[model samples]
Target: MTLIHPAEDLGVLRFITAGSVDDGKSTLIGRLLYDSKAVLSDQLSALARAKHKRTAGEDIDLALLTDGLEAEREQGITIDVAYRYFATAKRKFIIADTPGHEQYTRNMVTGASTAHAAIILIDATRVSEVDGRTELLAQTKRHSAIVKLLALPHVIVAINKMDLVDYSEARFDAIRAAYLALAQRLGLQSVRFVPVSALKGDNIVTASERMPWYQDEPLLDVLESLPVGEVSGSAAELRFPVQLVARQDGSHADDFRGYMGRVEAGAISVGQALRVLPAGHRATVAEIIGPRGELAHAHAGQCVTVRLAEDVDISRGDILVAAEATVEPARKLSADLCWFDHEPLSSQRKYILKQTTANVFARVGSVDSVLDVGTLSHGQHKGTLEMNDIGAVQISLQKALVCDTYEQHPATGAFVLIDEATHHTVAAGMIRAFTA
Candidate 1:
């Protein structure tokens, strides 16, 4: 379990574990933490102290490390996303262990939205035929679909509990073949398969001798070997949503009237012209100041105060974009929405739309199509989308907002809807295109 390598000079890979309930998401993560020497001695001792044993055998329930809630511990299921951090010699990792039940699909989406890769677990037992046919759990496909929808570039289908199926190569091959077809159809860019026994610590951080047929790298090796991200954020279009207008604050630098926000995409340098969104006011970047002090330029993910050559009417909701590569501003937007409310979405009802650094009153113009999770097709003419339903929707915002399609740039292309009465997040949205 002790891994030694040169220190990883790479960005952390944020990944999430997803599949059907009891697919061993938390257990797989716990095994990774344990085998990689990431868990502390006290934590292992605490795991022993907890009475929730996986079996009569003395194997400490690995799942307990992440099932933090009492209900989750009692029911032995993950209800919400549990975040855990660990590092190998070659790379660091942030794992989001999300719930896998059908009702909690929203939690899966929330976790997948930020992840660079997804580790979709599958119980090998399911592949064994009880009758003439085998029952395939829809949740696995559901998670894969969501992963594809989020545009995640890396995907690993973890055929977990290989030991249960006697570590048979035929079984593993059958499952992998079926999964590859689904993965390709769902538009997954990169896909790999690894047979793992999370409970026995097989093929987790290190290769397992029992599964000699799996000639490829172990799970950890595959994860560390994968690229951190598809590309550098600075390579994309410059998207700076102005969160604060730094003015009127008492300081000797009273003349410091600058727009302050994090760069969501692309890069900005001094003297680079930026277009104020919605207003279309143009200005050149005169100075960029970070917490330490002046910066010659800034890239995506950097939060800096940008001083413009001329005063422009910039507000909290306004965005500053690279003049050469700008976004479309529209009052009406077409988007794919995951309905989170218990009640179906009504086209006549109103909701509050919260995009990056901005809010607007919005109403559903129409429901174009609802995704059929069972069939993996689109064609639900149903007027309303119930909870856990995803569909294309046309929305009309009270005011024009600047946005790019989710495929173009994830940062500015994503948004959420809040209920007007209850003030709860009702839906998660990904912009598709601007409506005419």
Candidate 2:
């Protein structure tokens, strides 16, 4: 088989998988990679050797392939977001396999933050057990809410381990119903459900004869058929956060100054009118330079330096946006946060908030409420947000930030919270619709 070149695979899809522990998140990914012919022969042989040494009655556990750490193998759980890459004739895919334990929910947030779609796994046989059913549903709801808050548009519910239930249609139907209810509550627009046995490799790559009663498309079929393109809202406005300022004084260039950064949203072209934030100065794009050479036009994903017609006071943390689509300056911000660190987030403690290339000193003004994933309700909380907990909080920034809605501009609306004393990232935040 020939390898796909980067330029040939222009369409790339980033996706993540989440579910309660032992829901087969890892096994499903391994099967997808294995059956899709993404794994190498050497890796396959290693896996075969490991499978040969398995316990007498236990089947070859595909999850073992992705469980990297000794602790993870011992516990049989994923603790960090394990990333895998694969490509096909149609598109290239980056899969983030995240942990399902409640304590590792923060890792889920980290993985889903950059994903365009999410795969939520559910075990068919455990859908009826009280503890099992409730936990699974709750985890699904939580994962869905976070993906939505980040403005992800697609979701695929993979009801795994169908073989354990004799590939029964009734079991698949019941689990599908429960998941549909949760998706509806969460306002998910693009959703698909598939019955799969990740361990047995049924309905994952090819249609399963064991489940002839089910007539829907297989999991891989659905993934390939889904519309894979740049999301719609991402093309709404033009916002570029200045990462660095380049200056040159040479024979070809005399006192040339440019702001270098990646376009956060929309498209930009030479001579496009730009409005600098905070300073509120208007200028025209004189030239757009990419790594290769000057470009006539640039889009959301490109990293390029922009030179303006006239020099304006611009600095790091400042945003240059289309004059017509510029947003209001914000001092106080409201955000949905996923606490990752072992230390609980405290409202009274100060932290640093990093937005794109801009790092600003900020403090948590108040802890609004913690979300109860199962009920989709909020509980009043004021003390601290523990690891893996999702909550809404208010933050007071030292300087005003120009930002659009998270749904409107994901790159600019997302931020990371760092502990002031330890200088460690403690949480990931999505800027919600701002409060007046």
Candidate 3:
């Protein structure tokens, strides 16, 4: 009964759960936390005494654990992204229980942006068999398409509520086959399927005894075994965005200047040559400073202060990269966007496009195409992108931005568009490629 401490040298796996409304996403998460011994006794007591229990006969409604808002509890729906952390002997997990309703698609995008994997739930009872063909829900298709767009490393399709279906292997197989076709059309890889009853706590943390016909590992085991981080591509390339410039002037000889930020993509070591962009100033790493002390090197995810061998005109919006790396600065780019605002996107309106530490004034040059989530096809844009719409569009920036394709490096490729007038974030975007 040993659990790994979150800070005890275990790799952290960030994942999100998505499905149609009432597909048992919250229940599945609660079961994982409760059965894995991660929930505290006091929390369990609170759950037992919860007045909004959805289950009958005094049975605890596990879904209540994540539906935190009173309105959500009363409505039996998740409104915002609910994050939960738990650690097993093998790895630490950060699970984001995202809302399943179509309107909350933006919240799902937020949860999936940084996730290493995505668990898409399928309600066994929701799958309708018509004319010997199964039809998946629209939300399910939308979420899966998003997971594909984000390029998540792994996708686990959990066919939940098996108890409601008599733990039927046929139901699981049918749903799996149906999802597989969708996955193929979306070009999704690294997908795994599991059958579980989130309410009955079957095949979540452990193998289900009733589903003896199923031979695959349980949901928890599959999650623990999956490889984390960038499994391939330019993940090894160094891409650090300078967040701040630390300066101290005691004397000319004692002048201290350090560029501070998190190493977003690869690794950096002392003596490594770096190119500052879009200024493109070249310098050698003089030192790497952490809060504790100076370090010889820093890797991705570590926040540190870097002193270059020579003083360069580096600023907050500047990016530092391996000098030999192939990167370009562009003033125009194409991107995939998930619009989140009630006001539809206007090509003429200006936005503050923020990527990492860089912020630049930009406008949607054109609305290339909008996705039809149900049919999984793209159609010509109708001049405006409405709330919860996903589309490919071109943006013109006032300043050149140094970036990579989202498929190449997610940390550097992701950005958010803020309404210039309201200052509220209007959309989340991933750069497809630089057009100019």
Candidate 4:
């Protein structure tokens, strides 16, 4: 079976699909891959003979392409996050097909954490006008809230199953207006709406003649044209988390004492002044060694070993920043925590907080508030967090950590909590403020 991968020279776009259960997200993605000719003949043949075909005879069930698990196929639902890759002539794309159930909210959050955009599908039949007001599903609000929390650069609201509604323009308009209101409330920027029928392949890869009133670029065009801002190599602040320290023969005339890591944010060059974080020791960059040997300069996303003019004490988990930057080492943090484990979070339990290359013991000092997805509001916390619950909390750490707010630099601002006993990841956190 041959697999098709995107060309190396083309720009890549990574996005995730989210919606309520049975909202046709899998079908939309399957149709996208199929129409783009990413599927191979052997895979198509297997799909044709598959026993869990949902479509009528001789017509393949495109959704089967994404719902790969035995149980998912039988249940006609997506449970885990599924990733698919395809490319058009213009751009390469990575699509994360995330689960839609409320119970799988954690899975959706995991899928969206690294995505540049999110395609939120809204089932047409499930929404309607009541008392001169348009009402949407709870899952729709829940997923949208998560997208806002993640600060995804773009949002594409795909009103799916348009064919089922006879492609009504008024129905689409009402849903669009209601969604716009929700987006404004959640502070979601760069939101675009499109009406589509994933099953019938209308307005997915090409323009749909059926919806002549809807005059805009199709879904694929919107995706190809969306600005993927600062993917890498941008002028953002410098943040280098030391993953390893390379050393060689100290007694030798030409000794090596280099700090090795990926440049998470801005650029770095030889002779540039740098300050070692948590220690506040200052040094100057002397050399940078890339995969191809010596490099005079390096930017974000480039992994290299850097030699310092003065070798101050440095180790793994130490951060290097600009000399003039203001950073404080704090033992307490105000953060937004998303609980992902089956076991509820207890304030008395201790977990290892893993951020960038640093790992430190941490415990929940207080659960301040819990997010109400239904209302898009924060309510008083009940003192503990269940699975898929998000809340604002104060965390106390065993050691001081130097970092930035999530809105400023996501690399150093985000972290995950690991249960010390089981070594399982329990939650994801975003830093908001440093406290005493």
Candidate 5:
């Protein structure tokens, strides 16, 4: 397989596909790869073999292409995020096909976190059918809200299984209206509704002739045209978290030491003044170093080492920021957390909080509320947060942390909660506020 470097191609777009069970998310992705001619011959042969093993007269199970795990195959459901890569002439794509079951909501969040766009699939036949037993509509609304909260720029609503509804425009319109209402409520800005039949490959790579009422671009066209570069531009505040301290000793010449890290936000230039946070010390950038040589400027997403003229106390977890930018350092934080582990999160329970290469001891200070996804309500909870549950919690860190709200800077505002005993990540959290 050829490796396509993301930096070399600025048109690479990372997106996630999410929906409730049987919405044809897996099949839609399979069709995309197949229609785009990204699937290999050997992989196609394997798929054919898997098809022959299935019961006769059944459609080729496209879900087989992504359900790689033994457990997933046996259960016939995607359990984790399955990453797939493809490229068109216009753009290269990396897609995270996440599970749709309620139990795997955390997996969906993980897949959607880094995605610039999201494709939400909905079965057309089930558009208006109310399911009070399962609260299907409520679940869909919750998924939409979470995706919006992550600040995804574009959302494509794929009304799949159009063939099952006999290509009814009314059905498609009804589903589109429901989604639009929910999107408006959640403050989503960009949304596109597409009617598709993944089984027959309609309105996927090419527009479907059966649906004459719809005139928008095909799904692939939308994917190819969406902007993939930096969304906020260079106006945001400069943020660089120290990842490693590099020191080189030269016997014949001079000794050099620098702080190395990826620029998490904004831009920086040589000789620009900066401040070391948590320590509140000031320094000047003596040199901006890269792989080739010194650089005059650096922007978000670039990995570089910076040498300061005056060496102040600097270490991993310390943040270097533009001197004029204001930052707050605190020991207590309020966060929106998505529990991922099987074990429940309890108040006063200690865990390791990892943020931008720094790990600190932390304890759950308070459990504010647990989100009831089905009711779209916040339930007052004082106990444990189970798997796939979203809740608000207060954490007390062992040391002061330099941070920003998740909306301001994702790198400094996000963290993983690690189990102290097993060293396993239990939850992912977005810092909402800090208490002085």
Candidate 6:
């Protein structure tokens, strides 16, 4: 056996497990934790007490481990994104178990935005009436579309409930073929198919004896072997948003005056030059300090106080980027909107547009079209977007925002629209290239 070198090991693989309600998403996660011994004895005792059993025996209702919410337990469905952390000998994992219902698509988006991979479960036993057809669910397709849009590097299509289908290889093959076609059409780069029985523990933690015809790595094995994705810095240009002005405003004000924020992308070195966005001021990095102490360099995700060579009037929402790779500032942006509110959007009405750390007043200029997840087709212009609608929209911002296209840089490319009075987030949007 070849030993995996320490340098090659990816510390953790963040992934999301999503599918329609009652598709056994919670059970699968519980099974993974229980079968892999990730669950504690106390958790097992609690599961026993909950009495959410599929059968009458000592079989613990695995879903109870993730369905922690009282409402979820009562209704027998996941209403929000439930995150769980577990690890195996090979690699660590952060699992986001997102809700499957179409109404909660926004929750799924929130969970998957930072994920490196997506495990979309398909209910193999779910059959249609009339003639007994088992096509993929529309929700599954919708999740896939979102995952594709998020640009998750890895995709795993787990055909679940194989036991209910008598562990038929033909059924799994058919579903695999159909899903593969969908993946190709959606331009999903890397995709793999697996047959599993989340309830019976087939192809999850261990290889099942029932599916003898299949010979491949189990679901956990695939997850274990997948390479961790690169840091955001590698995916996009440098973008450092100033969250605060780190100043004592007292005796140490002169010594402690620095810009405090996260390195959203790329690295920062002591002597590197940076251009402050919106302010259009140039400065050189004089120092970088972290939580521990001083740092010569800082990379993406590291929150550090950056000292500049010159005192530039930088405020919250101002970005520090490489002078060579500066992005364009625009007030009008064409973007794809994921409307989460029950109230349909009105083009003439004013709303709050929050892009990055900046919040400005805005209004919808146009609703070009709505996308049909079922057919992967775009429909004619809809005047308003109802709840859980995905469409193309034009937004006019009160102030210009330095931004990039979602295809170019996700950090600056995505934003949310909020109601003026309620302050509730009504829509999430991604830049679709056109900006002015």
Ranking the candidates on lDDT from highest down gives 3, 4, 1, 6, 5, 2
Q: For candidate 1, write residues 376-401 as lDDT tens digits.
A: 88888897789999899999999998
Which digits, one per residue and each the tens of the lDDT, describe model 3 over residues 175-237?
Answer: 999999999999999899999999998999989999999999999999898887633224238
Which tens-of-lDDT digit does each residue in 263-361 have in candidate 5? 989888888889998899999999999989999988888899999988699999898888988786889999988888998886667899999878899
lDDT of 2: 0.81
What TM-score quantifies how close candidate 5 is to the native fold? 0.91
Q: Model 4 clash pairs?
A: none
TM-score (C-alpha) between model 1 and the true structure? 0.95
TM-score of each: 0.95, 0.92, 0.96, 0.94, 0.91, 0.94
lDDT of 6 at 293: 99
lDDT (C-alpha) at residue 310 in model 5 = 89
Global CA lDDT of candidate 4, please? 0.89
Residue 296 error for model 2, in Å?
A: 0.9
Best by TM-score: 3
Candidate 5 at residue 148, lDDT?
Answer: 68
Off by over 4 Å in 4: 1-10, 128-130, 231-236, 248-253
lDDT of 2 by residue, 53-149 (tens): 2324434456766777778777778998899988776677899999988888878888988887889898886665565553345676777788777
Cα misplacement distance, residue 152 of candidate 1 (Å): 0.5
Q: lDDT per model, in order?
A: 0.86, 0.81, 0.90, 0.89, 0.83, 0.85
Q: Which candidate is the best by lDDT?
A: 3
Which candidate model has the greater lDDT, 3 or 4?
Answer: 3
